[model samples]
Target: MGVKIGLTGGIGSGKSTVAGFWQEAGAALIDTDAIARQLSGPDGAAMAAIAAEFGSTMLTPDGALNRSAMRELAFSDATAKQRLEAILHPMIGARARCQAEAAQAAGMQWIVFDVPLLVESGHWRERVDRVLVLDCSEQTQMARVSARPGWTSSSAASVLAAQASRAQRRACADAVIYNDGLDLAALREHVLTLCAQWRRCK
Candidate 1:
């Protein structure tokens, strides 16, 4: 089997940017968030379960997940969040496993599982060979998120508060990539160097 690396970071920590670099370096990527989104899209695998659990209010006119509504509900109700996760996590995990197996069979040297909640999930550590965390300060995270359209400082702070703390994520990390204050080129260079080292280790 290929080396399975769990890639994670809190919101706006540049985890996606690092994952993109790994992809450029030939690592097969399996993003759980992307899979979850796909599974909640129109006529998606998890839609029926979601609609059943949360009712049609959680679905869009196109029969896809109403993400905004669900987000609101999830933040407002812990039981609702758990119910939604119960419906989606298993499906996402199964699909991710299948895709990882396929990549292994196809002779991929490395398979990066890009999961936003890797530390919080508590199961990914046992599934992957290594955990790579993109580290940044809370202020940096807030700034990055707030800069995005439709996001304010309060919204960014809310997200940051919901996720695992930096210390918590760092404790679980097998490797850490500090992304604060780095430009794209600098970050890419750092990732390239790390990829080289990982490849050599493999």
Candidate 2:
């Protein structure tokens, strides 16, 4: 119902920061990741299915999905990952679309769906009016991710390798923000400029 833009980037590429800027500018953001977090939190809507499928050991003491265990399982076992996705992806998509419809009903002009795997997700390409990619070198991504708490070079590399390549992401983008060395102010400026240009979100 509005100019629904899909904002995306790889890990540590400042995707969340850009989402924040859009939200601060009054765009209704349907953040899939945040919705996933909610679905995995204690007694969440998907928890029952997860426990039923993956066994109760996949849940923590607080009845939340044991992320570390699930992550390990997903990587080592492809079918495990597929099973998990089968449970969560539909839930996330449904919630996101519902929120989006609500945002449109509220007379909002811009609707941003912040999806990290927009390029990899087949259904997302047609769901939005535009796709925005936050472009950065893989080396920059590795360095930024490795600097985070409890992260190491090997782990960062693993995470990067698992995602869709930068080339694939760039190929799918309608616009690209090359975010290598820009400061926060410059980045904010870039987002705002795009917002102004794309502000015709009727």
Candidate 3:
């Protein structure tokens, strides 16, 4: 694909905001999380594999994946998380690549892969030309996450613990957008500038 950019961030860092700007600037965007959820749904290719691996506990009454139960299992056991990733990540990556290729074939100048787990999945590092991180402090992340109804501070902390640390994510970035306190207009302007640079690279 032409100039594939990997966009990622820790929880609540506003990576979606930046991705929106890239979309506005004409870059094709593929959100891996959305694709992953699809792949983990009923009739998904990974369904059989997941069922075989985790057995009936991972299945819902309607015969689909029990996402809530699976989420808890994955978080509680490191091996469960690894097993889930093994079944889902490769499929997600392949789907993302296919979309990017389609965009390139259509003559798009850039493709942005919004992969939240890019830093955690070392295998994905080689798939993109650049990594754009939307940076925010852990405290900010916790606050934003906890403020959501039904989420406790500890629950938010568990989600944060599952991802790569802030320092690790920062180290992987080719460009970083500090998103701790900026307003939407400022964020939009920053993303516009970044997109301009990306287009120039083409």
Candidate 4:
């Protein structure tokens, strides 16, 4: 394959924005979060299983996974979180692998797997050439998430608690982008510079 990169970072870490920059630079991006959203949609492949596992109350009137209710349940109940992960992670991984294969077959020199849980997954490390983490302080995480619609400081903390710590993510990263105070232009410039280097080296 080409330069397969496992892109990950905590919630509110501007990971999505950075992923967009990479995509704009010609990298084929497979985002697990987007896949998860599709799988949890009303007509999603995983909806029936989710409803069966968590009962119908965990679903919305439209038969989709009730994300807010499910999130609350997952945080308050560890077993629920594990069960959800069990149902979703394998499906996400399989889909990602297929997409990566297709991208490589299309002659894409860069394939970026944007996984929010790359470090926690434990299986992605060997599959990728590098792990790129979008780094930011926990405080910044809280602030950024709270700024989003329907999110509060408490919910942000819960999300941060669920993911790997900053140090742990950094420990596993081959590269890190500190996005705490960087503006969009600077961030884009930084990303393009890295893309240039990687392309030349590739």
RMSD vs true structure, all candidates:
1.2, 1.6, 1.6, 1.0
RMSD of 3: 1.6
Backbone clash total for model 1 is 0
Off by over 4 Å in 2: 200-202
What candidate 3 gets wrong by more than 4 Å, as runs, is none
Error of 2 at 25 (Å): 2.2
lDDT of 1 at 128: 96
- Give TM-scores for every candidate, taking all chains together and pairing residue i with residue i: 0.95, 0.94, 0.92, 0.97
Off by over 4 Å in 4: none
The digit string of per-residue lDDT tens for model 2 on 1-202 reads: 6789999999989999999999988899999999998998999999999999999989999999998788677668779977888999999999999999999999988899999988877899899999999989999999999999877887788778878999999999988999999999999999999888877543
lDDT of 2 at 5: 93
lDDT of 2 at 35: 95
Q: In candidate 4, what residue range of length 10 has the lowest lDDT sum?
A: 193-202
Q: Please provide, for model 3 over 119-181, each residue's C-alpha lDDT reduced to its tens digit, 9 standing for 90 to 100.
A: 999977798999999999999999998998777888889889888998999999999999988
Give residue 116's error in model 3 in angstroms: 0.8
TM accuracy, model 2: 0.94
